[model samples]
Target: MKSKKVKESVTIMTQIVLPNDTNPLGNLFGGQLLAWMDLASSVASKRHSEGIVVTASVNNVSFTTPIALGSVVTLEAKITRAFNTSMEVFVDVWVEDRSGKNRTKVNTAIYIFAAVDENGKKRQVPELIPETDEEKVRFEGAMRRREMSLILAGKLKPKQATQLRALFE
Candidate 1:
């Protein structure tokens, strides 16, 4: 398979927060935001894999600010790294001010997806080449995140996580 650039897998989505999408406190519901993030990340992973992809895990979702009702929310997702059959996606959520002149980052999340064939069998994905400085940093951090995820899932021993261990050493 041919390698693809990070820019090729970028996905952006925008939504207007409505009353039903928010909580009684008038802020967007966390679950609603999570759903949007999942969709955005899935699209990004599919673009990178060029095939059906299933979400394997969601990691490090940080909700820094509350999005109020009537806010214009935007989600941008990109493939940070691609492994044999899996890819890591990063999603950023931004909320625009009432005047639409300013935007603030409200949330961020990381998602892992596994490419699959028609029969639901795992399939290989193309390598990802990160060009920009931010993309390069995210690409490098993906290994450590993956290792940590594996350890948390009990699929890898703590000592076997070379990338994570390197952080302390």
Candidate 2:
């Protein structure tokens, strides 16, 4: 496993689902889960930069299971990549059984956030310190997506990365 810098200050803060956050069917609301994703993503961005982070996009949400009330809904977040002031955070929501038994993933998604200065101008984000093989794999995934996004945005001209950079830059 390749060990890289894992930001110790990276926190999963201010957000965990509790019993009172459940719905009529005793399942936690999906919107609430998504909201927690945003929080986790912002925390990851701040951890990477300690600057104001604003969400730029959310890729997709896949719900593999329902979240039961009274169960622990934990949102784990990590910065898989950084570009200029933008940081990509991969978040996963899991449910810990009431008996403290096992955990199951309920949802997964990717979030993009841009760090800004006090005047709201974009600023540079700190580099991500990947610590393990898992982190390295995640970093590669983020980089692939970033490249794909550039291609889709017409920023990365096919077969001419240098030219594309010069043009876009």
Highest TM-score against the true fold, candidate: 1
Model 2, position 11: C-alpha lDDT score: 51
Model 1 C-alpha lDDT per residue in residues 1-169, reported as the tens digit of each score:
8999988989999999999998989999999999999999999999999989999999999777888898999999999999999999999989997789989987889999999999999999999999999999999999999999888888888777787876545
Q: What is the C-alpha lDDT of each candidate?
A: 0.92, 0.74
Instruction: Report lDDT (Cα) of residue 150, candidate 2.
Output: 60
Error of 1 at 4 (Å): 0.0
Q: How well does each candidate superpose onto the true structure, as a TM-score?
A: 0.96, 0.78
After superposition on all CA atoms, how large is the RMSD of candidate 1? 1.5
Name model 2 segments beyond 4 Å from true: 1-4, 13-20, 148-169
Q: Write the per-residue lDDT of candidate 2 for residues 69-138, one digit (tens) a residue.
A: 6777777788887777787888877778777698887777888898899999998776777778987898
